[model samples]
Target: MFVRIVKMSFHQDKIPVFLEHFHSVKEQIRNYPGNNFLEVYQDKSNPGIIFTYSVWNDETDLENYRHSDLFKEVWTFTKTLFNDKPEAWSVDKLVTLG
Candidate 1:
């Protein structure tokens, strides 16, 4: 499996708007092709910082989703509220726990 992590920092007041938008389409993203799991994390010390952690079946699957309409729509809204450059990376799972 391949994992994708995206870290984004948003304007404090925009957090609610962003979360509302995410909640609107979270289910569709979860069910996208080859998607295995998805989760959003927030920094306890800095609530404005958010992270998207997801598992995909492979690189191709991830690429497919990135090129799809879902990404376009979701990202369009997401980018507008970002206070900092969102950092993203792909990785392999080296260890796991519940």
Candidate 2:
């Protein structure tokens, strides 16, 4: 599987708004072909710092989603709330215990 991680920092006051938007669209994103899993995480001490973790069947699937209309609408709303440029990385699983 291909794992993708995107670290996003949002203005503190915008967390709720961001969460609302995410909730509105998460199901559609999760339904994309080759999508294995999807989730968002916030820093324990810094709630405004969030990370989006997702797993895909491969890079092609990941790219396909990125180019989809779903991404355009989602990202358009999402980018307006970003406090910083988000960071993203694609990686391969190295180990799984259990």
Candidate 3:
């Protein structure tokens, strides 16, 4: 499995807009092929900082999603609300416990 995490810092005032956009597109993302999970989180200490945590079948699946038109549309709108450049990570699972 592949794990993807994206850290986004938003202009404080633009958070609402970002949330609205996220809600609108989140389902599509979660349902996309090869996606096992998707979630959005806000930092407790810094509300303006948000994170997207997702699980994909593999790196190729993640890359395909990134190249999809849906991603382009979402990212184009999302970048405008950022206070800083976003950071992303795609990693293979080392271990898991349930």
Against the unseen true structure, what C-alpha lDDT does each candidate score? 0.97, 0.94, 0.95
TM-score for each candidate, following the candidate numbering: 0.97, 0.96, 0.96
For residues 33-92, what per-residue lDDT tens digits would candidate 1 score against the true structure? 999999999999999999999999999999999999999999999999999999999999
lDDT of 3 by residue, 1-98 (tens): 99999999999999999999999999999998899999899999999999999999998888999999999999999999999989998888899999
Which pairs clash (backbone N, Cα, C closer than 3 Å) in model 3? none
In candidate 1, which residue ranges exceed 4 Å CA deviation?
none
Tell me how far candidate 1 lies from the true structure as C-alpha RMSD in angstroms.
Answer: 0.7
| Total clashes in model 2, counting residue pairs 3 or more apart in sequence or in different chains | 0
Clashing pairs in 2: none
Q: Name the lDDT of candidate 2.
A: 0.94
In terms of lDDT, the best-performing candidate is: 1
Candidate 3, 70: how far from true, in Å?
Answer: 0.4
